[model samples]
Target: MIDWLNSTALTAFGVATTWAEVLGFGTGLLNVGLLVRQHILNWPLGILNVLLLMVVFGAAGLYADMGLQVVYVILGCYGWWAWLHGGADRASLAVRATTGAEWLALAAAGVLLTGGLWLFLDRLTGSTVPLADALTTALSLLATYGQTRKLLENWWLRIAADVIYIPLYGYKGLWLTAILYVAFLTLCVLGLRAWRRAVLA
Candidate 1:
């Protein structure tokens, strides 16, 4: 399965798109689409999506992104359980706005993690776009953590990360993954609107 996933799925626009990238693209779309609807299934599908993307990013030498996927898998697991039980009296989760303190903490953590990952990737790995990779990776973790908590601001963080990710994936020749991020950006917008309505209700 690993070998097959690493093999070429198709040649599009002269780029040999891997099976991992193609499947990752599909799962990523489904994951976010479900997320927009506040569905629990998004967690499992998101886990699958990141697992596939780990292979794709590994091949592309985006080591930071590759490592990010591993963390995403752990976050995905926590998100799955949280959505099912992390509410008042251990009920289902509900959408809510982030607290000001939470926002400040997330911002501080994002900066610190980005700087730390940037240095590690730049000095310890062969990552060519270490800063951008680290930035997006940090933003993605913040977004995913917010999502797990049913925070509306998660969509904003996702929008920020996807904007950087689209170009980064494209530069790495992962055309399908780049396109996936474009779709992700659109989903993030929809998610923001939907979650806002949920909070207002």
Candidate 2:
């Protein structure tokens, strides 16, 4: 199983990648499905997705994104706990919109983190597409946090990241991952709609 998961198998758009990516892509889609339904199981599936993709991104030299998986693990744990108990009397968190101040804070964090990581990846790491890598990483962090907090806007952030990721990963030769983003983009739209209705409920 380990060998098979770690094995490189497919070639598309002139780039050869691994079975791990294929598995990661499949699980990622599952993760999105669960999130769209507001199911807490998304956290565990997302954790698994991140672990697999970490290897794939590391192999592709997207060091920032490779590191993002670690963040996802931490966020996944937090989201799982929060979804269970981050509410009055240990109730589940409800979907909601972010306030203006909250939006400012999130936007600031994304911008600053993107700039810092871009510089570090450009100057220190062997990363080739530092700008796009850092942007996606930053946006992903915010989006994951938004999901943890049950914010309706998380899906928008993810959708934005997905648009950039499609071409970015494609250019980096992660064809399967790019395709996964396409699927994610579609799911993000649906998640946004579902979560919006959830907010109304």
Candidate 3:
């Protein structure tokens, strides 16, 4: 029974990780836009994808990415609760554009966090491309936080991160994951368009 379970899990993990990444990237594109548009249902779907990707990144030995997944789990929980009760009178959160000041702050924070993480991981873990990896990881965290708050700028951050991640994952031989990011890049464009319409409406 245990062996069967293991076999099942392994097979499911293999197929689901790659396929789910493809599907999940699409969902995530919509999810992030929905988030920025203050749609309540986005949180649940986002959480589901995050949980799945945690296992996938772990198996791939992308430790920074694996750690980022753990962060996503927490962000998912926070996003869920926030979307439900974050607005006035405990209503759903509202869609909001980012202020210029907020954009500056986010950029500064991303740079500092990424730089620090790169230094730590490079020294302790001997990570290849630690700077690039940490930059993506840090920006992603910022984006997730922005998403939970229904901030419009999260899509921009996602677009920037996906640009870097395409080659990074491909270089690492995570071809499927790289492709997923490519798809994610396309989705980001669609998401931007969708959210713009939502905000204008």
Candidate 4:
């Protein structure tokens, strides 16, 4: 059990990794931990996780996700600033829920962005799973944007993305990342509950 769990996969590309995966996974866990706690540390840990996962995804031929990491860096910065100063008198941000209209708009945007990215990847890149890649990437962008706005529904979006991410990364031979997403999915649920109570409070 220990060996199977620890073993690295995908040696053909010379990208077989266990420790890097562990480090990245650990950092991601911490990032979400801080997020659940509504602490300020989530941003920096998120940056570190993005950097690490960029290498992981790049090696796995998920170029869209690699690019997504770059976007994550930018969003992380924005989220950091918003969390610090987006409230009254530069206070910490408060949690909020998305309106029905905003939800509809976000759904429309998610679909359009997915289609656009799928076309882009299919035509311009050597992506093996462009549709799945595009869909997850687009959803992740929306979720990240939701987090920056301090929306409680962001965790739902993340959970949605992870549903695809788990199988995608596993198929790509990033077993560790696949495992991490399982952890992430669980955390997303917990985060949703935590933020719900936070909003009520």
lDDT of 2: 0.92
**Against the true structure, whose lDDT is highest?**
1
Off by over 4 Å in 1: none
Q: Give each model's whole-structure lDDT.
A: 0.94, 0.92, 0.73, 0.88
Give lDDT tens digits, candidate 1, residues 1-201. Answer: 888999999997689999999999899999999999999999999999999999999899999888889999999999999999999999999999999999999999999999999999999998899999999999999999999999999999999999999888888888888999999999999999999999999
Over 1-201, each residue of candidate 4 has an lDDT whose tens digit, in order, gives 334433564343345765446677889888988888888889989998998787767766889999999999999999999999998898878999999998999999998999999999999999999999999999999999999989999999999999999999888877767888998899899999999999998
Candidate 1 lDDT score at position 72 = 96
TM of each candidate vs. truth:
0.99, 0.96, 0.80, 0.90
- A best-first ranking of the candidates according to their TM-score comes to 1, 2, 4, 3
**Candidate 2, residue 46: how far the Cα is off, in Å:** 0.7
Who is ahead in TM-score, 1 or 3?
Answer: 1
- Quote model 1's TM-score: 0.99
Once fitted onto the true fold, the runs of candidate 3 whose alpha carbons sit more than 4 angstroms away are: 1-39
Rank order by lDDT, top first?
1, 2, 4, 3
Pick the TM-score winner. Answer: 1
Deviation in angstroms for 59 in model 4?
A: 1.1
